[model samples]
Each structure stands twice: as C-alpha cells, then as structure tokens.
Target: MGDKVISERLVGTSTVHGRTLEVHRLTWRDAPGLSYDVVDGATGELLTVDESFDEVPRLDQLCELLEAQQKIGTSSPRP
Candidate 1:
C-alpha cells in the first residue's frame, strides 16, 4: 500500500499580518519524519507544506513559515 497517514492534528492557531492561520501536524506511517501544514483560517486553503522536521516543530518555527508565506503571497508577480 502507499504511504498511509498516521495522524493529523491541529496544533493551534496563529495570526500573521492580520490573517489567522491553522497549523497542523501530519505524520505518515511509511515516512521517516513528519511535516507541518499551514492553512488559511478564513478560506481553508493550504498555504505551506513543510517536511523539514523529524519531530514536532516549535510554535515559533510555524510562525516563521507563516510569515514567509505571507510575504510570498503579497509579493508582486514577475512578468
């Protein structure tokens, strides 16, 4: 079978640039590590999928990712 999802839990919520985001922790049975996803609280859109952590990431790390996501979203598109 393909990689089965082991768990997915909402860590908490964080506000970045006046927008609220839902942070989630995702683990897979076949994967050696876990990942974190940031979703927009209002629109329920997935923003970031970061698989760089082998363990539970700290809140500050999630916040940093959110900040970076916000910056990318607000940047002007190149022609």
Candidate 2:
C-alpha cells in the first residue's frame, strides 16, 4: 500500500556528532503513526528517514532517534 503524506514540517535543528541536522515531523494518511526525517542542514541531503513510532513521542525520545541516526551515518566508511 502507498502512503500519502498528511503533514510535514521542520521541528527543529540540532548538531549531532558535529553535523548539523534538520529534524522534521511527518504524518501519513494511510499509516496511523509518526515518522521523522533527519536531513543534512548544509547540503539539503536526506540523511535519515525513521518511521518507527506508533504514537507521538516526547522531544527527548525524538532527539535520541536523531542522534542514533547521526551515529550510524557518521560511522560509515567514505571513499
């Protein structure tokens, strides 16, 4: 099934592992849940797309997810 975007907006910005990231909240029409997109603030590149929450999470919880993404992203070996 395809999911329709219900709402999407930038929640806030944070510096994780020395990289600036733009955190966005996204809701879907077909899916009754919340998702977050962590984007690279400088290059406008999408770094992480997490759709793991069944309900709205506290700001701290969101931060943890974003930080985890940052760690994962930064740990990858670059050519």
Candidate 3:
C-alpha cells in the first residue's frame, strides 16, 4: 500500500518511544469496532496502523500497542 492522507478529525496526540505521534480514530460502518492510525508528529508518515481492536482501549493500552509496533519494527526476523 501507499501513503494515505491523514484524517482531518484526529482524536489526540501521544508521546511514545521518544517520538510524538498523532492518534486518529476510524470507525467502520460494517463492523462494530474502531481502528486507529498512529502517524508521526513531524511528518505525516504512518508509524503503524493498529486495528483488530475490538473496543476502544485506554491510554495505557494504546501506549503498549504503540510500543509493541516499535519493537516489531526494530527487531530482526526470527526463524
């Protein structure tokens, strides 16, 4: 996939992994869950697209997921 435009309506901003990120809330009409896009603060680059969240998570939980994304990005592939 390619870069996407950031949503005009953003839920909030979060600070994680020594970098600031923009958190956006996306709701699907067909499903009963909400998805989120964690984008870089400075650049509009997408850091991660966190979905499959059955329900809206608390700030701490969101933080954990974001951190996990970072860890996955940094870690080497294992056999």
Per-model CA lDDT versus the true structure = 0.65, 0.62, 0.57
For this target, which candidate reaches the highest TM-score against the unseen true structure? 1
lDDT of 1 by residue, 1-79 (tens): 1287678888778776677877777788987677766677887767664333444556676677667767776322211
- Each candidate structure's TM-score, on Cα atoms with residue i matched to residue i, is 0.60, 0.57, 0.52
For all candidates, the clash counts are 0, 0, 0
Weakest ten-residue segment in model 1 by summed lDDT: 70-79
**Worst ten-residue run, lDDT, model 2?**
70-79
Off by over 4 Å in 2: 49-79
C-alpha root-mean-square deviation, each candidate: 6.0, 5.3, 7.0
Better by lDDT, candidate 2 or 1 = 1
Residue 65 Cα positional deviation in candidate 3, in Å, after optimal superposition: 2.6
lDDT of 3 by residue, 23-44 (tens): 6666655554456656667766
The segments of candidate 3 whose C-alpha lies over 4 angstroms from its true place after superposition are 1-8, 47-57, 74-79
- Model 3 C-alpha lDDT versus the unseen true structure: 0.57
